[model samples]
Structure formats: structure tokens, C-alpha cells
Target chain A: MSPRQKRQLSLEVNGEPYELLVEPHWLLVDVLRDQLHLTGTKIGCGIGVCGACTVLVDGQAVSSCLALAVDAHGKAVTTIEGLAREGRLHPIQQAFIACGGFQCGFCTPGMIMGAKELLDRNPAPTEEEIRAGLSGNLCRCTGYVKIIESVQVAVRLLQEEMAGEAGAPVSPGPGRHAAVGSGQGGAR
Target chain B: MALWPFDYLEPTSPEECFALMAEHGSEAKLLAGGTALMQFLKQGLARPRALINLKRLPGLGGIEVGPEGALRLGALATHRRIEDAPLVRERWPMLAEMLQLVASPRIRNMATIGGNLCHGDANEDPPPLLLALDASVRVISRVGERLLPVDGLFTDFYETALKPGELLAEVRVPPLPPRSGAVYLKFAPKSRQDFATVGAAAFVRLADAGRCVELRLGLAGVAPTPVRARKVEAALQGQLLSEPLVREAAALVEDEIDPVGDIRGSAGYKREMAKLFLRRAVAEALRRAGAAGPGPT
Candidate 1:
């Protein structure tokens, strides 16, 4: 087959702007991992079925494996590496770590990214909604029991944090797990 | 494996899209949302010389009410949007419900209704419901435009009636008449995200005193294309809504469907479930219609 022409793509990943030339066949996951060296995003199935390569395109979760890099032009792309704040882990990430959401850790990044989208949209999603939200992300390790709990914990952490920032009273609700601190080093 | 290399074209308008299609002819494929097209590209099932991404095209990504009070869904509207659209949820709950049941939430976020129909995948959930609702698609080319019923849209597996350069612009679903109800039911033996073993959609219009005025039933995953169970409809229409009548009518679906054995189920099992689901869908539709209040005088 003849060589494919490369297209220049300009995208906002996390808060950083990236301008790169990529082949039309280069998937977003490849560009993120191979070219940019942001390897937090994992690829399980090259097809869209597996959510291991889930990323946020303009705040909506999408499978990077199925998306061409050229399609990310002028769009804000958020991978697993972008989830944390200046130095603190995102509440979803903290919740996963605290709740034992992963075993092999292969699907953690994608699961956390999917959870981020879920919490961003529905701060306090029901268990059924959480399952529906994370249905795309397969967890061969945890059997998804702890992953579901992690989302619930994340919801409480986020709600408490939001309430704290607003100077509102934080009454401890029943069955609310204590907030987990970010023990890991500053965001990668 | 990496996708086969291909040139990507971003068209800002329908005319430009048509121009690209005209130039590339059968060598180009339109990309909307890329949920289906991307899979085909990566699996080497489709290696188009050019991919025309429709995201840049304006005026093709909204849900609105047309002049006749019909729901007009722009071709590029995502499945998630349809599932969450307030107008869709309130007016056509069945459509919204079915949309929610299509793949996972993330896939729904990226899959477009237009691409779903054009892909012509027989196992999808939307086509059967659309067919039962008498939905039609608006297709346009450089030459002219035409409206084709959803029933005739799918010619065969992965094949649509759209000719070269013809693009599906919008899907129009007529507003349900008074005392009418529609329901979509799918039997997935595997995970919830898996495609249905036998999917059934039924729309029933009831007159005064609970008499069936009109009925339509559409089945999926049991045929080469989404099929309307005309025999079932004929049996149920004009009959008094009753349990026995619905059961008898739904049994006709077994004869109308041509199911293929697959991992989901054997052909015989699917055919049996098709009849059962059809019965349940028709009965549920009647119940919903009765609860919807009395028909027009």
C-alpha cells in the first residue's frame, strides 16, 4: 500500500495545547502514547468495545482507540493524566485507590476517566447508574464490586469538598465513608 | 492493528459533502460519530480511499419539531442526546428507552442516529422501533431530495437504499395520535450491552371502548433486515384489545421472521423468543394506550 499523508492537528490536551503531524490512520490513543508519551491511557481492545482507552473529548467520554487523531483537532482532549489538580489526585482517583477499585491496575486509568465523566455529570449517581456509567470499562480484577463502591465514595468526597469550598455545613450522612487523602506523589 | 491509511475530508456543508462523495464515488464513506465506521476501518472491513467527517457540517446535529409536529432528528444527533432529550423522553418515551438500551453510555455518547441507520446493522435497537413508529428519513443529494420510510431504508445487512452521493439528512417520526402507545423490548441473554437475541417493537392505536384501530409491529435480530410483522398487525388491527387476541396475533411473528443461529442463541430459540417478546410488547403497548386516555371522538 502507498504511504498515507500526514495531517497537522492542533488540540488542547488537559490544559496544554499540542500541535503535531499525524497520519490519518493514527488513532488518538497512539498519538497520546507514542508521540506525546502520555501513556496513562491504556488500549485493551483496538475496537470501541473495550473502554480501556476511554478519554474525554470536550468533557464527554469517548473511546480514543476508535477515534482518529485528526478528529481531535481544535477539541479539548482529557486523558487519565489530566484528571488530577495542581498536585492533588482527582477525587475519583483517590476514591478508587481507597476503595480498592483495581487489582491488576490495567484498566484503572480508563475506569477513573469514565468515573470522572460520571461524577461530573451526576455528582451523586445511584448504584444502578454507576454500573450503567462504567459498563464500558471492564474490570477483570475487581469484578466491579469495589469499582462501584469507589464511585459512591467519590461522590461523597466531591460533595463534601464542594460544600467545604462554599463554606456550607458538612453534616455527615449515614453510610458515608471517610474522605481518603492523596497518598501518591504529585500528578504525573 | 492500525487502521488502513485513508485521506480524511471535513465538509462544512451538505453540498460540500455531496461534492466529496461525487468525486470519490464508492471510494468514500461518510463518518458521523465514528462508532461504527471506526470499527469497520480498524477491522479492515471497509478501506475507503477517503472518509468524509460530517462533524464539521452545520445544521445536521439538532433535535427539533417539524412543521407537522413530527419529531425531526438531525442525522448527526448522538444516541445519548436522543436518550436525554426532554422532548423525546416526554413525547416518545419508547424511543428514549430504546436509545438508552443501545450499547453502553459511552458508545451512545459517540454513536450518531444517522450512522446507526446507515450502517444497516440488523441487530441494532433503533431500527425496529423506528419502523414500528412509521419513521421516515430525509435523504438529499446534489440532484434532489427524497423521503424514504425507515422500513425501506435497510435493503440488506450493512446495506442501505441510499445511492451514491445521497446523504441521510434527517429522521422524521410522526407525532403519535391520541390513545396510541409504542413499546420496544429486547431479549439479550448475555450482558446488558450485548445485542438482542430477539428484539420487538409494537405501536398500537386504540379507538373508543378499547378497540384496536391500527397496529404495527417491527422485529430485529431475527431477519436479514428489521422487518415489520405485517401478519401480526393484520391479525390485531380492528380487534378488541384482549389477551387471547394479542397472543394469537403475536404468534404470527414466528412465521414472518427468519432468524439465524449465532452465539446469542440458536435460530429456533430466537424464533421462539421473538414470538414471546412480540406478545409481551403488543400487550404492553395496549396497556399503555389504555392508560394514555380516551381516543379522539
Candidate 2:
């Protein structure tokens, strides 16, 4: 009769690699929050229904609460804690602040992470697309209007950031209006 | 949702998986995506001694379509992959649309089609549509491999026909026939992500003069297992369908489903909904086939 044993998990989280021993039953959230002490990834519903524990695994959003930590071995994971660069807040975080997108701050990190994934995929998504993209992540504050407005502002900010990055007129995606009106109302 | 301590086993090959399955027997559960099984673990509904993860199993995560338009979805192909596949969107639009209606995007990214089926939840969205599309699953074990029609896969609540030491390898979906149209409708009024109050799927093929050449109806959330309404299909086969006639055939579902409703609705409400949705799904399928007018004759 064999006893349950811990397994070694090696994963790159937010550009940092770590090697740790994790229990077989332990979830990715457990490894991230408890082991690594990265408490930004919240566990809301425990089940996958709430978007509280959402994280990016290999660039695709998935529920950390439902994923096994060992299964994340050899993969790249991005939590809400990983978004900043050079001690400056990511544009999504800035947009959330600029637009007052959050209330009580419990769902903010997850919302920002979800938005980062969404904007990374489609730089300029429609309001409906933004709503559907973040469907899994719920805001209990019922601040959906400002949350959507925050995403819209992020679209413009990201477009401006990309336009600045590219140093010329750039087409973000298939969305025409988000691109053609580049100069007007970008920061707001 | 504190999971019990268990040994984690990652098998790189099917033979190794089968061997482990044989050794662990029912005490071990095969891990595919772990979206549902994790719930089973956290809720203490399943106290497995080990979890044999299928993530490392090679050649099982592919999504390939044959030249004949048949889709061979490897067991590990995530719902996100299937939903975003270009060929699937072009050929099997009904399936693509249905995948979008599944839980949220995060769940879809983590949930695999094989895992969803093997989870054997009667209220899930995929089984009804897969049943209507005439999908079959390739189940493998140490002895050999065999294909089981999707209908024969589910045995009961959270149970499947897969024997011990066997695992689902792939899901094979045959191409839709010419002049055929398919649809899946989930009646979840509360939230788009909620399990269906009742789910219905229909595949219809038309011959000349709009006569029904073939019809298949599948329903979920109203039975012990996802069920095909063969009696209804039999009644509509080779007949020129009218709204009244289709409604008459759909009414047969009232007796076919055995729903034990909880918060969704009463069992009687679900049975009634099953009949109504069966009729609507068939009508929509017919219209999509261009076999009938916008309003059914």
C-alpha cells in the first residue's frame, strides 16, 4: 500500500520561475496564494463559477481554483500580481483607476487580469465583447457600467500605448472606429 | 472545497494509464481538465486514492478534421480550441454556437470535451448536441479499443458505460448530411451560464419538396441520462412536416423524460419544457435546412 506523496512542480509565474513541492490535491490557487504568498488571486466561489480565481495559463484565462498545481508544471502562469512593469501599474490598472471601475477592491485584481487577457487578444473589443470576455469574473458591487466603461477606456489607452510603441499610424484589429479616431479622447 | 489528499499520477502513454487504472481500479479517477472532478473532490463526493492525469498523454489533444468533413476531436481538446477552430466554425456552426453558450470563457478554456462527457452530468450542454450530431467516442484500455455511440456512453447520474481501466480517447463527429441543418437550444432563463432548465438539440435532413428525410432529437436535464427521442424521430421520418404535426410528435417527450427537478423547476415543468423545446428545436432545424418557410407549414 503506497501513501500519498507530494510532487515537484516547476512553473514560471509572471516571468519568475519557481520550483516547489505541492500536494497532489492542492489547487493552483493554493500554490499561488498559500505557498508563494501571492494573495492577489482571490478564491471567491471555490467552484469555477465566479471569476475571482482567474489566471492566465499559457496566455489563456482559466480558473486557478479548479486547476491542479501539478498540471501547471512547465507552463507559464500570470496572476493579477504579475501585471506591473518597472514598478508602474499596467495600463489596465490605470484605466480601472481612471474610470473608477472598482468598488471594495475584492474583485479588482481578477477583473484587471481578465481585462489584460482580453485586451491582449483583441486590443479593441466592442462593449458586448468586453462583457462576454469578462463574463466569468463577477463584480458583486454591480458596478458593471463603470466596469465596461473602464474596458472601453483601456481600449483607447492601449491603442495610444501601441501607437506610441509603433511610432506611426497603426491598425489594432478589425474594429475600425477604435482605430480611426485615434487622437481624440485617448487618455479619458 | 478542501480536497482530500491523494497521489497524483501522470501517465505519458495509454498503456501506462491503463495499467495504473487497473492497479488503482475505482479508487482512482482519471483527470481531464479537472473542472468538474475538482468539485467532486472539494465537495467530498469523491474520495479517490489517486488521480491519474491524462494531460501528458500524447496524440490525445489534437483537433483534426478528415477530408470527408468528419471531425476527430482528441479527448483533451479544450472547449476553447473547439469553439475557435476555423473549420468547425465554417462547417459545424451549430456546435461552435453551442460552445459559446457553455459556462464562462475561463471554464471553457479549462474544460475539455472528453472531460465534459466523462463527467456524465445529465444537465451539461454538450451531451444533447453531441447525441444529435451522431458523435461517437473512442474508448481505450489495455485489452483494445472500441467506439461507443455517444448515446451508449452515459449510464446514469455521474456514471458512464466506460468500464474500469478504460478511458475515452477521442470524440468522432460524423459530417452533417447534405441539405441538413442542426441546432441546440438551452432553456436557462436565470443566467447564460446556468445549467439548462432543459436542453434540446435537433438535426434534420430534407429531400425534395421539403419532405423530412431524417430527423434526430436529443434532450438533457429532463432525464436520468441525455436521451434521444427516437419515437419522435420515427413519427417525423419521411413525412412532410407541419407545425401541428411536429408539435404532436414532440408531445411524446412528456413521457420519455424522468426529471427530478430541484431549484430549476418542478419535474412537471421540465417535462412540459422538454416537449416545447423539442418542437421548437425541430422547427428551427427544418427552417435552417431550407426545407420549410420561416413559419412552418
lDDT of 1 by residue, A120-169 (tens): 88888999999988878888888888888788878877877787768856
Candidate 1 lDDT tens digits, B1-297: 588778889989788888889899989989999988988887788889988999999999889999899999999999999889999999988999999888877799899999999999999999999999999999999999999999899998788999987999999999999999899998997887889998999898888877889888998899998899999899878888667766777788878888999999999999889988888888778778874322211
CA displacement after TM-score superposition, residue B173 of candidate 1 (Å)? 0.7
Q: On residues B189-246, what C-alpha lDDT tens digit does candidate 2 reach at each position?
A: 8777789999999999999788898788999899888889888889999988888888
Native contacts present in each candidate (fraction): 0.80, 0.78
Using alpha carbons, what is the TM-score of model 2?
0.94
Estimate every model's Cα lDDT from 0 to 1.
0.87, 0.86
Question: Which residues of candidate 2, in runs, are more than 4 Å off?
Answer: A1-3, A168-188, B67-69, B294-297
lDDT (C-alpha) at residue B99 in model 1: 91
Q: Which stretches of candidate 1 lie over 4 Å from their true place?
A: A168-178, A181-188, B291-297
What would the per-residue lDDT of candidate 2 be over residues A17-55, giving only the tens digit for each residue? 999998888889989999999999999999998888889
